[model samples]
Target: MNQNKSGPGTSLVGWNIKSWLSASVNTLDDADLELVYCGSDVPSSQCLSLVKESIPAWQSRAVNFDEGDFFVLSGQQKPVVIMRAKSPTEAQKRDAGLLAPSAYGQARDLVGRAVSEVRKFKSQKVNLRFESCQDREILGALVGLELAAYSYKQSVAAQPAPFPALGLSVKAELKDEAQAIAMGTNIARHLVNSPPNLLYPQSFANAVVELFANVPGLSIDVWDEARLQKENMGLILGVGGGSENRPCMVHLRYRPEGKSEAPLALVGKGITFDCGGLDIKDPAGMRLMKKDMGGAAAAVGTLYWMTQSQFARPLDVYIPLAENAISGKSYRPGDILRAKNGMTVEIHNTDAEGRLVLADAMAVAGSQSGSDKPAAIMVVATLTGAIKIGLGSDVAGFFSTDEALGQVISKRSQEWGDLMWRMPLFDGYRSRLDTNVADINHCATGSYGGAITAALFLTEFAKGYPFSHMDIYAWTDGERGALREAGGSGQAVQCLAGVLQSFGL
Candidate 1:
């Protein structure tokens, strides 16, 4: 975007990154901000603090925040969390046909609408306004940018040249911390957008380890197909049987301090490309199956975010990456298979393999991640077609027995303008997944509640944990919307990061 007081774009920037972070830092002012383009080599802090500061400093005094150009996240305060500034005036003008007063309110309206669009898979490039407002406005919009970047792309090299990178003028706090978060998110964008052919199970685990090598107190363990078999992850082994490339279960542990009271476990479904096994999809249906592992990508994003920042609590994340391909060895329908959970699932549909592999990972985390009773295990995935039909691509479907926990996730997502809809885990839905010959069917009994049935299948595996499942259609588009882009978007990363930062969990 030109800086001619009235331009139509966004700019991003970065610092020496290392220099900005080396010194013990706290507090940031407007002077610390930089101006670069998104997707540029620019760097920023990996924590929430950096994202907070960038909003107001870049808007040139038009947008404001709750306190200053940036403010510390309320409820749980460790350091200051800067916000992006947004201009309701500029926003309304850009919206042209909008009907709202106050730039912030208009901002709320526009960004929210764009978020809805992105969720629906209607738009890809999400553009929001950030002005000289204190800081919240711009920060919030930037957060939206992060959310928009979550969709899986074939590869970063194939993606648009790059987004304009912007800098946050900070008061005193080390700006690199904030930029680090951006850097991490940007890297996540690259990882998720990569094609399945290049980013297989082991390679994907390698990427995770490589990304966080700099962070202290983080460890990663990757189990190849051999180890998984020996360890009794038959479900995972069975699903990966058809692939020429062996499957892998990657474990990343982030231990901050003292024994965790309730260390959270994040389980992501990493089906790099879902061929639907024997139950193959048509041409259009399988077009974007490469992004099947979006759930695992989000998990990777979350782990990286927490690692980059110094936060309390223990965090353990599991990513099960595999290509659910068809092969001679692929488990055939009607084949009764045993899992790490000791339960046998009669293969009703090989296409419904995400929940199968995820079951093993959840069990591994159950034995690991350090939680006895129930840990806050958030499982993310582009799970079912039913989700697309029920919530569409615009809204991520959330299923959790713990209403409070689900509410927190939803609220933070809403704040960032990521659309999330909570669906009921009605017991009646389970009947749809009942299998005549097996303990339970891999898929729902009928197409009537596809999304719910998938969630229901996952529930059986997550029974031991306080699990919250997000059935993201991973597609976007629909009626009168906010954003208008149609490509791989990096969505939901911000909301997850925001919630983690806000709750300091």
Candidate 2:
């Protein structure tokens, strides 16, 4: 075993992290600042000797243990944490206060508690000691700690508080996949956390270029408003005309090594801010509009993950970047916009601008698919409040034109811990977008099945290609579980990444 060195640890923003297994413990000094997890009976272990000797008084309180309950033990310089580790069966029982349905929930919750204790004591470094845990479990805990430690501040001044350095007692092993996924998620969160003023269309495109600079097997192409106009993408131009920032489409391609099959195309909505254009939105409804580009964030994050993890596949992502704000130049309710595919759309509601931008983007992506490539198209967006009303805030509603693709997405979502529910495309609902003046209306007139109708509107641009659409809430309303907070959840990046990874296999 290699002797652990005390140095500047790798952190998400400010929190340092370390991982180890029980067998790697070489000294009692390592347990000087530690978190001990044991079952209700307190499993007997040699590592716990120091913890037991140091705090016999608090150890007695474990006579009647509750899940997630912990007791703090004082050390010479710092406090030691002793937490009750819930069994897998106990964690699965929802009534036991383990709200996260997965078995890994207990381990993740432990990290959350550790972060709190570290903050309370203002400790600069802490260690997590675990027994009989898998590598993924420990990785999940560390990922949780990194995420909980993240806080976005707009100040240029020095940071107010210190973030703790974490040490984990798990076998040093391959952590590339876990860390890459976490990094991707953090990328999405940082993008979503940025205020709209800093993340407008052109700037957002620049950010993607900067992020992918060091990454290999990637190519980026961005089209400004003029270029979009030249391509006759009137839908995108119409929606973004109100904002001075201009509208753009960014194409990121992941070129595979050697001979590979057709690419899987991903389309994400990049509305930097949705002021609801001429239709306008309520103040309360517009407060969180900074996350309007969450779908784009997710797509970017997934690409980050695949590239960082070196997943072998040819992939293409199309992101339509814009800000749906109100101004004299904004498209109004009665305007007809033409898509890149030469199809005309009547704008009944300017608030339904997401689908409009996506329409042109889908056309751009779908047009690239042919007999030689046979690419599959998938669209991700925060398209409607109706999805939130139907599936609530935590779950995303997805619709797919192809059944096999839908099943693969659903399976991957569940496996990756991303919650998704499949919604019906309902070809019968296509008429909801009918308009006398144009080929289609931007939105359905009636209130019912708005999510369905919005998805149905995209199929016209897809042009009978195999496509899947995910309408994600993209922000957590309350605490859900590990790596999830009230801010940007980076919703379906994991699910999308997983599907592409598995499909390639």
Q: In each prediction, how many residue pairs overlap at the backbone (N, C-alpha, C within less than 3 A)? A: 102, 5
Candidate 2 RMSD to the correct structure:
5.5
TM-score leader: 2
- Which lDDT values do the candidates have, in the order given? 0.58, 0.73
TM-score of each: 0.70, 0.84
Predict model 1's lDDT versus the native.
Answer: 0.58
lDDT of 2 by residue, 1-505 (tens): 1113221113322212222221223334543366666533445333355465656565544534443345676754556776655544655444333223343345555665566666677665566666555654565665556556555552112544444455554434424555556667666777787778778898889878766654456778899888998999999999999988999999987785663778888999999999898889999999999999999999988887677564657888899999998889999999988889999899999999999999899888877735324368899999999999987887799999887888888777765657678899888888888899998898999899999999999878886678889999888765556543468887888788778887644
TM-score of 2: 0.84
TM-score of predicted structure 1: 0.70
Compute the lDDT of residue 445 as modeled in candidate 1: 55
Worst 10 residues of 1 by lDDT: 11-20
Which residue runs of candidate 1 sit more than 4 Å off their true CA positions? Answer: 1-132, 141-168, 171-181, 310-312, 369-374, 475-485, 502-505
